[model samples]
Target: MARRERTRHLIELGGLVQKAGLVELADDDRATLYGAMLDCAARVQADDAGTVLALWKRRGKRAFDAEETAEEEQR
Candidate 1:
């Protein structure tokens, strides 16, 4: 990916974390955040993966839709 695109992708992912309150849950502990991500990865790799993915997809779309709505309201 282009550098700018990659940077934007990373920023968006960080925003998702902030939207989900993960940053506050981590309490500035990088290790805790990393560990939580590893655990999520393991869950995604395990059985019933669709369940995890579907839930995440719903949540992510909800966040994106909310942002879009907020922007439209601002306009």
Candidate 2:
């Protein structure tokens, strides 16, 4: 059950990548997609990691909130 849950979690993360249009933007190139993620990881490892992470968190939260609002309006 734990393994299944983990698999689902990973799939949802992949869905976010697709939803973000990275898959299409990279033309389905796995290497490029991974490199982009690596760059994000590097940014989080920098001296201003906290500030960088906070900005990303805020942006992600806003995006999620906007998506939810749009879905609710459609309903």
Candidate 3:
């Protein structure tokens, strides 16, 4: 993906995270998310559809982890 597109995706994901009340993500978690986003974006830019999809899958896992952590904290 283009730089602009990558930035847009990151912003979109950030919004989703905020709405999910997962804004308390640790610095390491945030970095991981950002890094994954960047990796996927780069893959897309390189026209590697498979790699992009894989990166997105990884990103989803990270998001799930964040959500689970937040829920656990409420208990």
Candidate 4:
């Protein structure tokens, strides 16, 4: 990916962590945060992933779209 795209990807992933309440759950511990993400990755690979992922994706998209709309309206 290009540098700009990579940066945006990282920012979005960070937002997901924040949105999931992981920041507080990890309590500023890098290892804890990483381990939690790893666990999540593993869980996503399990059965029922499709249904779970669809719901998550829908929520994330709605949140991102709402933020964009709010920002545009503010301008």
- Best-performing candidate as measured by TM-score: 2
Least well predicted 10-residue stretch by lDDT in candidate 3: 19-28
The digit string of per-residue lDDT tens for model 2 on 1-75 reads 999999999999999999899999999999999999999898789759989989989998999999999999999
For each candidate, the alpha-carbon lDDT, in order, equals: 0.89, 0.95, 0.76, 0.87
The better-scoring model by TM-score among 1 and 2 is 2
Q: Which pairs of residues have clashing backbones in candidate 3?
A: 1-44, 1-45
Residue 53 alpha-carbon offset, candidate 1, angstroms = 0.2
Clashes of each: 0, 0, 2, 0
Least accurate 10 contiguous residues by lDDT in model 1: 14-23
Kindly list the per-residue Cα lDDT of model 3 for residues 1-75, writing each as its tens digit. 599999999899778766655455544387766676687578788887887778868987898899899999999
Cα error, residue 71 of model 3, in Å, equals 0.3
Question: What TM-score, computed on C-alpha atoms, does each candidate reach?
Answer: 0.75, 0.93, 0.39, 0.63
**Candidate 4 clashing pairs, residues 3+ apart or interchain:** none
- Give candidate 1 regions above 4 Å deviation: 63-75
RMSD of each: 2.2, 0.9, 8.7, 3.1
What is the per-residue lDDT of model 1 for residues 1-75, given as tens digits with 9 covering 90 to 100? 699999999999887778788889999688998899999999899859999899999988998899899999999
Candidate 3's error at 20, in angstroms?
8.0
Off by over 4 Å in 2: none
Model 4 C-alpha lDDT per residue in residues 46-65, reported as the tens digit of each score: 85899879987899799889
